[model samples]
Target chain A: MKIEKTEHFLNFCCEMGRHLVQSGAEIYRVEDSITRLMHAYGYTDIEVFAIPSCIILNIMHEDHNYTKSIRIRSSAIALDKLDKLNNLCRRVCRETPDIDTCFAQLREITSAPLYSELVSYLAHGFVAVFFTLFWGGTALDAVIAFASGLAVKFANTTLGRMNTNIFFTNVCSSMLMASVPLALQYLGLNIHIDMIIIGAIMLLVPGIAITNVMRDMIAGDFLTAMSKLTEVLIISLALAIGIALPMGAARMFLGVM
Target chain B: MLRFLPCLYAFIACASFCYIFQVRKPRFIFLCSLNGAISWLVYLLTDFLPVEAARYFLATIAVSALAEILARALKAPATIFLVIGIIPLVPGGGLYYTMDYLISGDFAMFTAKGLQTAAAAGAIAAGASMVTSLVRMLTWRKQAHAQS
Candidate 1:
């Protein structure tokens, strides 16, 4: 490969790694995918390293080393996009497609549309309702949880658009989650406050973070694992504080514990 | 019948999560939701276990194994199934109650609930990692034999 083409390929590999991490892939998967792509392009001297928030790629060709690094600021789990990207990588490895063509395909996968906003809101509501019922909440509790879930989703998207940090977003949304049911109880509604709060809180839980942390640890990426574990703890603390603030206020002012 | 209501609720919740996470394909969504149901059912059946965390551990082992199999059969990543499937077993309720106890000034109960939540989370991580490592080992050995 020519020097210019090698540089483009290196950039392409770095972009792929960035997308994988942004799609919430395991650290090892990102590293392995980039390494395999480089080897598929007939490069023997390439190194790839990825963590939760960054990827570094280096390639040596013709006594010249090219290095590219990308810093990822945020990520959300989108399994459909992840599956498409995984397939694209496998196809590129098998066919050794031109770098430009590969870039085009990557663009398509990344640009794919997610479910509509209405669908997402409904999904959040249903998740809360069903989980409330799953935890022994009554019919009234499920109804209230469904509404609270929609409110939480609205808070999440609005805060997300404002580019607020995740800790603040979670804290605000969780406060909403707790206060909604407390407000209902104040209005003389027969609802299970704990059940409704748990349901809405499920939308903000760190289940995926826990799963990814374990996988990263098993992959021997102790640094990534520790960072992600810290993320889990921080999110959990934020959630607990968010809930405690509202409950404490209710108990102190209204004696509504 | 009535006893399985929680499992049914778990199924619907997981299916909804599939949309939130953008699982997209109908087949995978249904399978992932079913896995959630299975996870809760396993948890319920293992009520005989002495420790509550043990039930979560067993449920997670089942989820991880099923996710590995589904990934192989569907040619998709195990995370597609594993993340959604394990949702039902996450200790969201435990975390909430722990905080509730803390707020109510019940230090003894708060401590107990806090420890229980931590143990549950630890058990889940251990279960998932153990199964995943075993699968990785088996695949690695198989590839080595193929090359030899």
Candidate 2:
């Protein structure tokens, strides 16, 4: 089954755009890459509009125009995927690979394996412990943070695999994280509980949302910025509520440790 | 030498998270972590400054500028580093304290910590946006010149 050349080109371009957006590339970059890719494929009149979750493209060829609107709902931060997609676009522009091969390459990039679960858990744990050290915590504090980090990471990964709602996941993992130090305190380990809790929760902070919202706005993508801003607010609110739940329960049950 | 220890830990923290983010290339992981370390060092060095907010703003400015240059040189998005690199300066401590005070019914402390966290967040945003806007302007000028 062979598709028309223009249709295939449009399909490829849209697929690339969708993947770029889904992988958390900035909106302006997505639009710019798509436009550049189309121009490289000999399309003179092309228009691309990308928001955080949707990409609309119009390509004009031989007196007929083709339009495609791609809707992408969920996005996660994957810098490796973004880099790969970026490189693919550059290569496509330079070499003009055939559409089938290009699509195959795109699939490969999209399906690239992520870091193993064990690596992710270890990385999160180490990051938490290091953050505790950065904040002048003692070795014991770092160790407690390490444990909490592993717990939270395990919880997060499990919830993510289960496809649970993000807000609920945030609340559950954060409650689990914040309660670690409290439990240690209840055990009378005499540690700086605040540092351990803060370090563990740092792994759950909305750093990506915070940075990307500003980046999108700086790149003049206000719609994406607003959406991302809402996302950040929701995540941060979830974090606050999540941490507060266990803390409130601890105070109520244990009478202010 | 003593002060550098925290910076080294900041680098490790950034590298660890970058790994979790699946940044595979060793070169990229090193660059991102180095940027994070430099920015943390900047924050630490500026601790003697009068205004605490300035610490975050200045460090973020340094990080964003470095990320821009690195992005151009490496041909990767500035964010691959910027997001993780800026983490060490984020007011995670302030945020925790804010929530802690609120939950403990200490309105005075909560207000203070809340304001400080908000200020730090604002500073981070301002600094990154300022640097990005400047870089965009410079590149726009270069493109215009090249076109002409």
lDDT of 2 by residue, A175-208 (tens): 8888888888877788998888778878988876
Q: List per-candidate RMSD values in Å.
A: 1.3, 1.5
Candidate 1 fraction of reference contacts recovered:
0.78
- The docking category that best describes candidate 2 is medium
Q: Residue A100 deviation, candidate 1, in Å? A: 1.1
DockQ list for all candidates: 0.86, 0.76
Candidate 2 whole-model C-alpha lDDT, 0 to 1: 0.89
Candidate 1 residue runs with Cα over 4 Å from true position:
A1-3
B70-109 in candidate 2: lDDT tens per residue?
A: 9999999887989778989888899889998998899999
Instruction: Show the lowest summed lDDT stretch of 10 residues, model 2 chain B.
Output: B83-92
Q: Which pairs of residues collide in candidate 2? A: none
Off by over 4 Å in 2: none
